[model samples]
Target: MSASSIPGRLRRMNKTQKLSVAGISAVAAAALSLSLVPGNADAETEPQAISGAPVIFASAAGASQAKTIQSSVIEQHSTAEQLIKASDSAKAKAVSKEKAKKAKAKAHAKEKAKAKKAASKRGKQGASRSESRTPVFSNNLDGWIKESLSIMKAKGIPGTYDGLHRNIIRESSGNPKAINDWDVNAVNGVPSKGLLQIIKPTFDAYHVGGTPHDQYDPVANITASANYAADKYGSIDNVNSAY
Candidate 1:
């Protein structure tokens, strides 16, 4: 069997037994050589047994062992190939998933940027519109009348510059603080006041929105009186008398 066991076995045997085993091994080697010869017809016959040990076909045993080792190696190689295929498939799926994630993030970032840009554009446009619509008026009759007319237009109250001017000139001669303290309205304890000489009750009744409530306020006085005259005489242009 093993080389280490051979020395131990020889040490245990007597001198005659050792000689007998050696002689048997020699005869067995010689017989195997003759069996392998090309012209020997006994090559196919069963080998003769040695006296102290069983006959062994070393070549056939080595070939069968080599075949077993080769089969094991082939099986291991096939297993490794299958493992490699599975690993490659997993890697491919992971790579595809990563690519899709990156694409989705890129699309989301692009949409966010687009929305931010649109919001910025809308803010700029709104600022420009606010600046354009802002009006600056001087503190005078012309400015006051124009401002009141703008408010009147917005409120759907009908009146014209010529009509308002004509009535204001006749009523208080364009003086915003004008007051008729000695008239019948004054005797009644409610004096006619402001650019249109409007009594307190009449002014209160026809007060237009968007103007200050003060009777001395030019725009307020004019718009309120104009609103009253428009309701009664169709327009301020028709009011030429004490009305």
Candidate 2:
């Protein structure tokens, strides 16, 4: 070989040896890192050399990248957790609001029911009072007799249907407009009129409260005459003949 070619060949041989050393050093570093891992103390770490090239160990860069990825993952997880918490809080608030709305509606329904019940009760009481105050009576002699009997009972005057009917038939034949124009009371300007045939002066003197003042009113005349009869003979039932 030439003297200059010998130096060039020696330089190439040194460069190849340096590359082989670098490849081996890289494989050793990879194995060391694997051994340093938490649960990989007994794990195998075999590195194959390809075409006698130096194995590049980018462990520091890979670790930096992994740390960045882990940070990003942690941040994503934290963000997800925060979103879940916010959603749960919103759901809870909605549930609470719905419950409050239902409670208010329930209370309103209860109050409405109570008011309806009270109104129904008041209506019933008012109907009962109306029934008591305004009784149904027929526009006839029997109805008048019964009505007078009712008034007599209220005024503490004693009489019966048979007694009042007999007296009314005897005196006026149940005629409310009957007038005793030829009687002593008629001559004295106070004629017996209406059913039970009571004179105006006598009717005025024995007029029961809550009855009409007119002697021609059948119920009023009957009530007043019965009052006089009750005062004289204890009850109209005791008088079978004219008073």
Candidate 3:
């Protein structure tokens, strides 16, 4: 073959190779473009890549949702913590109020106890003072008998001094201001007054010629009761029961 003919043949082969490469490149570019497009029926139907774009986007969206959830959870946790703190504060306040109430009640109870004790002491003192006011007779029986007999004779009562003394001793243990206040005869509402436990009605009936204060006088009370007994029982010797 000729040298010029051989060179021309080589050039034609090279051109053919270039055209095949260009066609192959164009086909690859078209396939890539189709894959990039959002809506292409053929591309949509094709099997996805190993590192899938849709899967990557879904993962990214999930991550974003997770972040949003985390933010909401943090906010909820904060609100719950605030609520817990408020509840604790309320509990503390309630406990404090209860403690204060208990303390006040205890104080009131203590005051009541103190008042009761003080009242009991005052009652004892009053009882002691009342007991001290009771009369005590002297040991000189004969002298007292003579004086009492003289008084009874002056009162115009038909009685010997010895009988009157015996009667007085039996009735009052020789105590002119003796009082017999028993549950049966002495009604709860009415008070027994002075010597002989003279009820108000009986004393009013018998009070002959004396002041209101004379009812408390030992001599006057004895004379009046003696006179009354003499009138009722005929004589002091005739009387059996003392009261």
Candidate 4:
């Protein structure tokens, strides 16, 4: 029963009724006390009814009820506070994880940018090298003659740049594709061809290894003619006519 209702109800009741109500109140207070006790399962296991004559509740009863209510309120508040703290912790972890992810992504992007810059730098260097590089030689009669002389020097074949150039100018006017179709050699079915006007029989006989077989090919014709001259007249500078 409620504490405020007790006085009013007692005023309206006779002694017998008040006695009955007081006894019930005492039992209720006793049960509430037992219920308030923590870890009292064994007490609850064997239920017992309160049996006694009517008695007034002590001031301690009201104090006990107030304390129980205050304790419950305090426990609820503590539970809510704990829940809030736990939620804050979870949020903090999530924020930290997101920050870590963003940091890793930023680092990866930075590395990719650096790698791309390095590759671009290397490509620019490669282009600069290409631009700065020199040609081995031009694909022309003069280039062919100079290249042949180098090969001739390696093989111990005797020839000079000026001597070879003079012979080429006189024989074919330095034309790599020149042909003597009306010469005595041509009359005998061996037409002179190329920069040094080399006939087919002589070109084939003196053709150096590792050179093209086409007598009209400038390098091959000059090298073969030099070889023939070296063997026939001891040097190409000694040959002033068709040999």
Model 4 TM-score, all chains together = 0.45
Instruction: Give the Cα lDDT of each candidate.
Output: 0.87, 0.87, 0.64, 0.87
**Per-residue lDDT for 153-213 in model 1, tens only?**
8877788998888878888888999999899999999999998899999999999987889
**Residue 239 accuracy (lDDT) in model 1:** 82
Model 2 spans with C-alpha error above 4 angstroms: 1-80, 83-107, 110-138
**Separate clash counts for every candidate:** 0, 0, 0, 0
Best by TM-score: 1
| Deviation (Å) of 170 in candidate 2 | 2.3
Q: What is the TM-score of each candidate against the true structure?
A: 0.67, 0.55, 0.38, 0.45
| Native RMSD of candidate 2 (Å) | 12.5
Model 1 regions lying over 4 Å from their true place:
1-72, 75-82, 85-89, 92-96, 99-103, 106-110, 117-121
In model 4, the runs with Cα more than 4 Å from the true position are 1-58, 136-178, 182-185, 188-190, 198-243
Candidate 4 global Cα RMSD: 14.2
Model 3, residue 226: distance off in Å is 1.4
User: Per-residue lDDT for 73-132 in model 4, tens only?
Assistant: 999999999999999999999999999999999999999999999999999999989988
Model 4 weakest 10-residue run by lDDT? 41-50
Residue 200, model 3: lDDT of 55
